[model samples]
Target: MTRRRTTLLTGCTALALALGTTACGGSGPVTAGGGDKALGGQTVTVAGVWSGTEQENFQKVLDAFTEKTGAKTSFVSTGDNVSTVVGSKIEGGNAPDVVMVPQVGVLKQFAGKGWLEPLSETARKSVDTHFADVWKTYGTVDGSLYGLYFKAAHKSTVWYSPGALTQAGVEPPKTYDEMLEAGRTVSDSGLAAFSVAGQDGWTLTDWFENVYLSQAGPEKYDALAAHELKWTDPSVVRALTTLGKLFKDEQLIEGGQKGALNTDFPGSVEKVFGPKPEAGMVYEGDFVAGVAKDQFGREIGEDADFFPFPAVGGGEAPVVSGGDAAVVLKDGKNAKAGMALLEYLATPEAAAVWAEAGGFLSPNKNLDPAAYGDDVSRATAKSLVGAGDSVRFDMSDQAPAAFGGTKGTGEWKLLQDFLRDPSDPEETAAQLEAAAAKAYKG
Candidate 1:
């Protein structure tokens, strides 16, 4: 929900800009031989939420594209507020050739406004061959293929320091209650039990989502996402109460509520994996492993490891996920080049470029497992692609931006407030219902 937008030059392009190279191309799996230059003299622009290392990794994929097609590509970061920045660009007649949409709600909104171009036949064919039908289903809006999900994050894993858990003499928990007990034991051993990123309201939504999915089952989860069931329903209250059990105990949190409310996403991960760790556990997407390894030099499956979020009340544990979709903009100047780039992204070759770089997962079934840099990433990618209908997308992403994606209002802000004062589930549920009703109607 950050509103800061920054322009980032692709790694190859940055070097090219400095050294005056002819093209931002590299020899990799996606390279086309025999000096193929079908896309020569073309330039494609992309905008997305990825920044820092993520942006750098994605640029490798673009570099591969340039190698194969002889077309140049540039990337810009829209920060977390993809909808606002991209929307403003469209109105100003300066839309990028392609945009990486982070939320399904935003994709649908853009398509409804006629701002997105349907996928080209070549792109659709690649998707059909490489991706699961469900991935395509998410990309389609009103029977038209408009977005292709290229990056996915498995959100149900809880990462922890293996050494810290061993010191506390507790195994990975199998149930929500068991996890809390382990937290208490770990806390008693002179370390904070969990590093909760309460400042980023979206993280709190994920906490509520995993609990709601496990407790209420898939049917209720779908209904709640669609707003067919009001937020004030008993199921919502039950889920809130379940999450409150973790939040209500300030001792279990790394820096208590106030400290957590000030920590951003990366800071929360640092609390558990930094050189002088303050907490034993951190919960989020599989990307947490990337943060630990890249920033803290902790190896996955050794210093850093994870387990599925524990089941609630003996039900099957849920696999909640989030992904970024690549869509061509209808009003962009480089439509042909944009479609070509989208088509290439659908191929296994493009996916491998990032998978091999670390901290990435692809839903493309055709991509080789060996492309992943580590065993943990490979296994997690396999689980996600094989999850079938059992996997549920992020709940907040399904709602309108006003309710789900906004920084300080609606679900994000409300959940932050709940974390601060979780004594009354019913009151929280009622407030959520009021906000959701207004959001869904608008």
Candidate 2:
């Protein structure tokens, strides 16, 4: 299809807070108050999908914006339905000045409706200088810049318990076949090999993406993502057939298919890292580290560790990622203040605010590695930033919302069905193609 890929933000949030902020290079602490009063009288309202601890960490970033720029910022949680919440507010003539858009497809929909303002020159230039070209490309739509990606995630990671793996006497696998064999070995050791979050269809989509990107390669990945290649294409069938190798084995999945479908994302992670562990591993984005450490009290490096998703057919492992982008509303009462926030978010200083708080990663290339709270985060961020042109955005996020982002229909539900009965790859592929065709056409 030759279409650009889009990324969406994951639900993981920062749980740990860094001690004192150390000066980086010659700049002072990002949150330190300064005399700059350019926005003394401005009040900017922002909205996003974060809640609980995630919302708190994001507020720290907004607080730093106020300290550095002298603007008062108020934030509201839109919950998981960011598009619907923002749309309703806009229709009511009470939209927030700025929004942290989780899905690139939603950003484009808002921009196409003339609800978004093009980036100010200052914000555009800041993004140009700090972020990589791929990030800039993701934020750009129809040759105009609208969104500035602030938070990013490395989605191609498999978190495993060191103690569980050691107990099974099996090292992390290097290839897909090896991973399947290791899963059987781990299962035989009396622990389920994997904690599959079948209840959350998005996790299943991620499982499919990592496998597709590695087996079908990037060209076919993009084609499938854009709907140029139907889901029933041979490449997709191959990927699904390969994934079936794991799903078909009840011993490899904790609680089996039915049990997996009952587990949510956080519960899946807990199954492996919680006090009385039932599973050996969980596959998801790098955000798993936060849940393991904060909720389960497990150290990231020693207790919970991850390996890149194993390669397929002897090729290099692929990196599939997602991000949250910031955009200003055209009808916002505080457009100036909103634009100022975007500019601030593009700088390494602003990114450092959340980076140091733990559980967050930024695409800002200029950000210092030391800003990350731990070694695991530092290494993951480095891999994300260093991937360059080899990186692929989340495939489902690039598709239309009806097909990709919706909860009960399209890819999410269909994949959940596939997880339950993985015996027929061709039948699943045909059903997926029907849903995708309708979504893309609409």
Candidate 3:
């Protein structure tokens, strides 16, 4: 159950993509200089934090690139902390030709520092054809698209076993309060209701984000992400108080609070899907479909299903999202080759390589729905495109690295404390406000 960095992409069909049909969006397959030479046999180095299966899948992508372009491509896994390793490389003037930035805030930091190279015309055309205007907006800073999303994920889903829910006589809830009631009912049936990955505090942060956005709505969400509203604001307290209901009810969470806190994200999913299932449900991105299939042999739509996070506090639930962006560095080494790889990635042919691999979602609007590994993935992709303008980026990812991305500090640590003891939202909010203030200032 290692969390893979997958996508929340929109797709077109294989025939449309193969025939160079304008019906898909692009005029033809993404290429560099039409039939131009392949970078004179240069090597492009790409750095990312992906490892394990995710790395394996991306290697397939790189391998495909080599087969078509003949330019050697190398990938460097950045371990647990990409910022630390990437920062060191940048400081030492050995920056990778391209870096897959998992956080938009970090990508913006690099762009602001002038460490990124502007997208070449070929890559720009791919972006124009494949992605939506919103993606272009996010990639653009000061009127230039320095980054393009290579992978995206929809984070507003609660994965559950339909048969288990049916046997328990519990229905997927449409509102926050109903969700709590159903959890209690499932718990009464001798199954824990929610599998929470509290050990990795980012999951804890995601929990808060889904609720906060649902309760407070996007205007407030944006203001708060930009620090225009303090964490001590009333909305923060309200969201935390709502979240406390499940955390405080030990029977509602798998293995109780302590065990839940000890379990990582994948283990949380495993608890819900293992042979003798301990829990009935887990909430995460659609990529969990691939995980359940890979680890437990669970079929997505049949064995597992999802519903959007319910509306809370009289407001419509917002679709929370996250993704990885590819940015070429202006470090004067193999820059053209790096851009060429990106241009190729922008094509449906390259995306299909990963799409067929399972667990990945692209932001390409023209990518065919059938290109996905299964119906579950296609449904997730449809939901992402159908989400339209209602989607919002992951809140913490929009905040500065010190406040959100740094492990054991700021939002991560504060939210972990909140999850450990849900009784004092006021105290948690105060601490969160203090940390955000200091981190934003620093």
Candidate 3, which ten residues in sequence have the lowest lDDT sum?
Answer: 1-10
Q: Pairing residues by index, what is the TM-score of model 3?
A: 0.89
For candidate 2, write residues 261-323 as lDDT tens digits.
Answer: 999999999999998999999999999999999999999999999988889876679899999
Off by over 4 Å in 3: 1-37
lDDT of 3: 0.80
Across 1-442, the per-residue lDDT of candidate 3 in tens digits comes to: 1111121012343222222233345355443222223443778899998888899999998877776556688899998577778878988878798898888788888888778877766567678877777777677788888888888898988999887798889888999788888888888887888999988889988899999999998899988988999999999999999889878888888887788889898898898887778888998888778788889999888989988888988999768888888888776367766776777677777777788897898878777788897887887888786776677889899899889987789898888788788889999999999999998897
Residue pairs with clashing backbones, model 2: none
- What is the C-alpha lDDT profile of model 1 across 1-442, one tens digit per residue? 2111122222333323322332224232333333355677889999999999999999999988787777899999999888889989888988898999998898999899888878866567667777888788788999999899999999999999999899999999999899989999999998999999999999999999999999999899999999999999999999999898888898799888888899889999999999889999999999899899989999899899998888997777888989999998877768767877877787677789999998899988888899998889987888788876678889899998789878999999999999999999999999988999999999
Instruction: Score residue 394 of candidate 3 by CA lDDT.
Output: 90
Backbone Cα, N, C clashes tallied per candidate: 0, 0, 12
**Once model 1 is optimally superposed onto the true structure by TM-score, how far is the C-alpha of residue 63 displaced, in angstroms?**
1.2
Among residues 3 or more apart in sequence or in different chains, the pairs in candidate 1 whose N, CA or C atoms overlap within 3 Å are none
Worst 10 residues of 1 by lDDT: 1-10
Off by over 4 Å in 1: 1-35
lDDT of 1 at 399: 95
Error of 1 at 233 (Å): 1.4
